[model samples]
Target: MQGFHVLVAGVEPTARQSVPQAFRVSEVVALDAAGLHLLREGDGEPRATGLAPLPCLALFATPKTLPLMREARAWIAAQAAAPVPDVVLLDRKSPPAFVERTLLENLAAANAALAGSALRQARRVARLRAEVEMLGAVRAGLDRFVGETGLAQLKRVFSTATPDFETQIELVHGAPLRQVLPVAGTGFAAIDLACTGGKRRGSFVARLTLLEDGEVLAEWRVPTPAQDGWVRLGLPVAHAGLLRTLCLVVEPASEKSPCANLALGAHQPLPAAQLGDARTGLPIAPHSLAFRLYAAVPGTTPPHSADTLMPVAARKAKPVPYALQALPAEDLARVAETDPGTGGPNLLFVADVAAILCRPGAGGRIRAACPAGARGLMASVGVHADTPSAAVGVLGVDAGAAEPALQRVPVSSGGVEEVSLLFPEPLREARDILLSAEAVDGAAEGAWVVFRDLRIYT
Candidate 1:
């Protein structure tokens, strides 16, 4: 009863109301085909009795109907605006061989169209049902507070009372359950620059990889376009448990694209792999890389219990000695190693042409000033040659002073030794310092000296 109702077009209008209920006949139209019919719905519009050429061609078959075929072909070629019948129902008690053949040939198309239409209708019904359910829930919630039976009270409250976070949280939790911490800082340079600049539209492909324990949790290669200076991507979040580390590598789709620098958190100016000119038949590597490490916190939510007792504990902050910098071979000039394969500290010399760079504090480029209460400078040094002796110098820049100061210490070394340059007095304002090792008694040119563990402590 809820489905399509058959409208017999060939039947006379006088017999429309007389049709049996089993036919589900909604309408009847006059036509010349005495034994033919069309199964369709009457949608309150003028219905056509004559069939369109497409349906006509689909209905009749065989050389015996060649004249009728010609007439249908002419009608189709004319392209006249006309109503198309949904189905062709032969009225003959037993269809002729040709008619049966014609129905077999066109049966698949009819079934496919019917299925498609039904699917569309089903989707619309489902959407309407969801909307009605949501509205019911809203009405129930409103009724709880206003003790109202209709939507008028809900509309009045919305029109007069402004909604706020506190009110919303109270409705959700009966009380606020979380605290808000406000933080402010200038964001990433790339994001800030892109926002300030006018948008230029284009799209590129990028890939993301999430890995842990040598297993790939998730990966995606997607195309993104610049819109309003930002390209947004929705990544899968369900695999958060599998992700201990995430790395994103952005590669150019082809060889022609130019490259840009990548910044990771607070670590900017990170050197990236260089991919030379793409046209030169050289393989290019992805230069933009970002990595993050995640750690899972162990805990569980407890059932709400107002009877639980609060525990007391005490904590304090203190400064502990930390390694300022490790002067590795890569950070020094004219560096050589006695046993490079052994993976030990390499030999660095004072005669080196360039002064080795060191951070007396955390991070690069931010120079650490000697603390007013700095106890001494600590270093690890040794001689590899016979007699095992060397002279090391300390270079420092004093606060509020332009000139640099130097102190020398001679080491009669046999094995690796921990040496300290204790300040004659607390260097109240020493800013920065450098250490250089050289042969003391002219033992050899470019004397081999092992250096490591350079630190300053208060």
Candidate 2:
């Protein structure tokens, strides 16, 4: 046997899913994904019935968690080898084993063809009209060739695999798993997947890697005749939000088994950076932003609010102004302890293109609109989300001063983007207050703080 057909067994208590199942040391082991299936002796061999003998692997599980940790060891006592692999390869079952046959048979044929025509000088091309084609054992044994290049050339030698082998692998690996916290996780729990497969379909391969930024990169290759599902893979890519998209690629491979792992080694977090158009010292047009406001003065600011509004139609190009403003210490008038700014007195949350949307008013107090409809007036920070992970911003407003109240300006389209300091019914003065915008948050760095379009009612 190439590898042991592993299984696990166990039972759920009458009430709780947590709290180990009552009694016994050998109740669960092998043949199940979650260590919850019951395998029994039917017709002389083990057969699963979801009742008596739950089947599952004892994967470093607490002996308290496994009723069968010891007995299951006794059961598999004969075939015992190295109990654990440096890496465990997990797979869902294939249909009637036909899918496995298809994959292996293709591999066999591919190997058979390679011994003859692949080394030929003619560079002959052949088409794989068969969907269940195998690309078995691409290359090894050649001392001069590295594993990847030989495989790539082998794919080229085959000539007829359609969207190409590497591409196909990428396609399969990219089947979107449910999003996870991206940077760190141990198993599927890092994602939003159910413990049991929901009507589980087809077979796929999973490969894991780690980036410098502590993100666990799970690259999966899923092959099927037709695509209809995306099992969630748990990973979150910092501010780079499409992290799940990066890890999972869905592709159409005829057979069910993976010939080789689509090992995408050492993925790095997309470095958040600034893009200057040259010549101008002012930050470039930012993709998004995140900014924060620190309330300098201590008073009943009544929880200030701060959210961004996308103004329509920017003003015509204006000449860039010169010389950085001196640290306006007076500007810190209403503020308390201020953290030394990063992103060069701009970006927040680190290394990302961002800027500060500082609105310093009345004693250095910054009233920012909070996220999730964070009502009331308070200090706040958030993204200038034209896209995810692309920005940062900070607002500086006055809490002690009674001037800038909350405002609900209506968009021309009739929806409200919620501008601040426009409440308390004194409509005229709210609009007249000297409102200044600037780049302070590191993430929203380089955004052109131009006067853009606005059509507000309240």
**Clashing residue pairs, backbone N/CA/C < 3 A, model 1:** none
Against the reference, the lDDT scores of all candidates come to 0.33, 0.26
Candidate 2, residues 119-171, lDDT tens digits: the string is: 55333433442322333222111211221111111000011111111221122
- How far residue 50's Cα lies from its native spot in candidate 1, in Å, is 70
On a 0 to 100 scale, what is the lDDT of residue 441 in model 1? 55
lDDT of 2: 0.26
lDDT of 1: 0.33
TM-score per model over all chains = 0.26, 0.17
| Residue 230 lDDT, candidate 2, scale 0-100 | 21
Highest lDDT scorer: 1
Cα error, residue 164 of model 1, in Å, equals 48
Each model's total of backbone clashes:
0, 108
List where candidate 2 sits over 4 angstroms from the true fold: 1-373, 380-458
List, residue by residue over 1-458, the lDDT tens digit for candidate 1.
22223334343333333333443443232223442223345465644534442332142212443444334444434553522332344333433553435444444555676689899999999999999999766644432322211111100000111212121100011111111001111110001101111222122233333322333222222222222222222221112243144323333333343222222122222232222122232323322112221111111111111221111121111222322322222234333332333433332344242223221111111134345566666556554455534555333434444554444445444755666666666666645554445445555433454444544544
